[model samples]
Target: MPKKYLFYISQNYSFAILRPLQAEIQRRGGDVKWYLEPNVNASYLATDEEQLTTVEAVQVFNPFAVFVPGNVVPSFIPGIKVTVFHGFDAGKLDWKGKNTHFRVRGCFDLHCSYGKDMTKQFDALAETYKTFKVVDTGWPALDPLFTTDTALNPYISNKDNRPTVLFCSTFSPRFSCAPHIFDAIKKLSESGKWRWLVQFHPKMGADIVNKYKQLESENLTFIETDNVIPLLKSADVMLCDTSSVLLMFLLQRKPVVTFKGNQQGEHLINVSSPEQIESALIDALKQPDELMQHIDDYIKYIHAYTDGNSSARVLDAVDNFTFDSLKTKPLNLLRQLKLRKKLGYWKLS
Candidate 1:
């Protein structure tokens, strides 16, 4: 019989991250069933072939392996719980938040690291728990960024002569650069020399979302979607804060201006405050070629593989866990029950 896998999508943004892996698994003669969060919109099921399953489906299907993008998974669920991770940023400070660059909660049976730095970290954490396999499979979500056709990106436009600027921000009220750089962005948008595209984290506050939505003008466009690979492909320069999206932009070997970011490395124009926005933008747009070396070095550090085959590697890890079942670890019952209740998975029972 063909193998069966379960993909747990907790949010809309997860589609961008998990779809590549799901498609690859199906190509390899495996079946994929999506178990979605209750809040996920029906519109996300864009295909007749794509059916939304539930926690009860997971229980009955007994998939060979379960892939999760978010950190937590129900401990009681059968099959190996595989963590694919969300982003590559290590964060600006020790914020103790959910997407804290890198973290390990003993909920997963296997931990797939995107690069060497993360592999070592997960290895150390696994030693402490003695309950998971740490494998260095590059993040599958980024596969599109490497192999995408630019023409498919809806946000691209050739209507103007101005350089395209993508302004992306995290949703965190404390760490986000949105609130701090609004005035500077407004001035730049009014100049008409640069085209601005604004995209934010899904969790960004309603007031802030509304505030930027109102900023849409001739030179400025507000994009509301989870898929950013297209925007990354289309922009000349990126303006961001401490969000992991900066890493995504950097992967293009393009110039990026960051406001108060936590981690520092090559090719990033780090500004202390919003006042430096104009100068930074000028420098980045004028000499983006000069920053390629730095961007290349950072990309090598975070992701060891750039061959557009990370989806294959991730699925190989899944196959390893499923076929042998020897590498799999049993779930921590107490932790499983606690998370099930905390994340509303218990409601399904």
Candidate 2:
């Protein structure tokens, strides 16, 4: 019998991240089901691979493991709650006193960690909680970064002689570069010195997205798709601030200029203010080939598996999980309630 697994999808963009693992597990005769959240936009799901909405319905499927791309799985749901994580915990701190990047709220039985730093943190958590298992499986979401397929490009446009610049930002209003760098981008877009590509986190406000869309010109493209690998592939350099997408761009072994950014890495040109973006972009574009040595070190520190087999490693770990030997840990109800309230998901209670 195929080992049934439940993939808890809360956002449409998450589908791209977990699709590789889902396919690999199915190839091994495992059945993967998507448990869509009420707010989820299921337009990303191409086939009817079975989707459930309630915890009771999830129990009916009797999943051997529940893979959550998002945090806080329903407590009543039966299965080994596995936290696959949505993004790289690139040393970003949360408003709360606790480490928001890797805090364990007793919601997961297993944590599939990304790199050495993140893995070390989760491994410590595993030691503290005997029930929790930490696996150093490089992020499967980024597997496509190493692939050669070009059809998956989010933007379809004619190739030009001009160099490409990809501008990306995180969703957090406090840390986003969207509000600060529009003027600089607008000037660049109008100048036509290079082709511009803008892609933002899906959670970015529609108003912000629309504002940027209005500035779109012949040389500029405001991408609205969740897939960013192709954009990363085409770009000669990336510009951002504090977003994990910076790490994604680095995986391409290209130069990146970050504004007031935190995580230190080689070839990462960190600027103190928005006024420096223009110069940074110019420098990065000129020496696109300058940062390979540092980029390689950063990649190794962030992710160990760049061999395009991250999905396979994740599946192997899942297959080896001993369901009977492991006992589920009780949910930290207080913490869960607080987080839900903060995210406006408390009504779900």
Shift of residue 216 alpha carbon in model 2, Å? 1.0
TM-score of each: 0.91, 0.90
C-alpha RMSD in Å of predicted model 2 compared with the true structure: 3.1
Give each model's whole-structure lDDT: 0.80, 0.79
Model 1 off-target regions past 4 Å? Answer: 92-99, 288-290, 322-335, 342-349
TM-score of 2: 0.90
Please tell me which predicted candidate would have the highest TM-score against the true structure.
1
Instruction: Give all candidate RMSDs, comma-separated.
Output: 2.7, 3.1
Please give, for residues 195-291, the per-residue lDDT of candidate 2 as tens digits: 8899999889898899999988888989877567778888889998888778888887788999877767666998877678889888887765556
Backbone clashes under 3 angstroms, per model? 1, 0
